[model samples]
Target: MTDTDVAPDTAAWRTPHGTSQSVSQNHLAGEVWMLLRRNIREALRSPVIAFIFPVLFPLFAETLVASSYARVSSLESFPIQPYTAYMAPGMMLLAGMMGSGYSATALVLDVQTGFLQRLRLLNVRPSAILLSRIIFDALRVLPAAVVVLLVGLALGARLESGPASVVGLLVMCSAWSVAYGGLFYIVALTTWNPQAPLAMSPLFILLMFTSTAAMPTSLQPGWLASLAHYNPFTYVTEGARALMTGPVTAHALLPAAAVLVVGIALTQGFVIPLFRRAVER
Candidate 1:
């Protein structure tokens, strides 16, 4: 139909996919918000929610770990922490890492579908494409975060500092999610492969395994031990654990924040260029 045949509100108003929407003035934030909102809504829908493997998988893993460790009644004799309490932060990080696959795959799909191209013509900001993916992934992980936290609590995980600590940890996780997700999006856009994000699992798993997530760094040996020292996951896990367990200190928070900032810096460095290329294409 011609523009004259459509309502004024409908005319020139369109979603990034060329669908009808109540379009108005364009700005970077608005564009990002639209993309983020669309992503979240679609994610919550049926069947597609299969993408929630990140959140659900962590809960299952945490439960199994807690159970397996529980079998060793000797675990309680440890002077350190209870099994549940120690595993909570690790599970939280796992969820965040897993959920990021959605954003990466979505970025690749957008590239394949020419969605990014359409957005460019509308004068959408180059950064917005990448930024939206980061923001959306962070928000998308919230439900999984909540599920993991609740599962940890159910499994007898204690949050010594109460609500404030939980909130602080969540904020930190969200930031990390954004940073990590941005990196995934960069790879997705560069490779133009939706499966690229799937390949990320083994790498992140290796990182988590080598880090202090599953055990304290003290037990590690040789180069395996060295990875624990520099791995971002280790700092993030310890930082989050500190927040939940009380006595938040620069010792914990600073290193975590530094890793997150460094990761973000690296992701943005590549994403900005990839986004520019997307726009130019």
Candidate 2:
């Protein structure tokens, strides 16, 4: 079985007590998995908060946005498919962003409660600590991933790229969630406040609306269309919608990853060092 599949505490039985430099790669990996699993468990501990809520939030968002355009045949007089189908991919990305908040909240707790200090005493690898929490946060978001896709499928969303697109979409969503989650965690670590990251909530929501999220840019006013065209989330939504309509090609997928790449590049410079300092403190 993989390290994640086993009991997390079992690592306590296997990890050799020694300096971080002396630890084998495999053992370090095991430690990372242990911490990753722990974070997942912590995040998912509340059923209402973790399970039912994530599943329902996407459905709620889709209905609300879809309802707004219900009376209109099409926004720009373009050939409009079902509103559900048009809105699904954007809703999925929004859900991923919402689900990432729990990771930041948990990190804030770690900072405030001195749990990070204990980890530093253990001599854990800084990368392992940060990456594991971020990866686990992505895992914790699986309910959103599955429930949103299922809702879309039921509402006439099709995977036009076939089986491959199914896997590709999941990978894309996971990457986006991890990158943003890591960014949120960094904000919490630096502020050392559980509520500091909440300020980001409005910014992200605005980004979603200003993009080609609910309606295509052609439907928007000239100014809004211009603004949406420049938004990174526009590319992300277009990339995802392409997977549902046509082919999962490099041309279709690269823009989706570009936002994530920029997120990682910008956040990595800050998150890793910030996390290290938090541990050192």
lDDT for model 2: 0.70
lDDT of each: 0.72, 0.70
lDDT of 1 by residue, 180-229 (tens): 77767777778888888777766677878888777775555778879888
TM-score of each: 0.85, 0.85
lDDT of 2 by residue, 234-255 (tens): 8888788887766567886787
List clashing residue pairs in candidate 1: none
Per-residue lDDT value at 192 in model 1: 80
In candidate 2, residue 140 scores what lDDT?
61
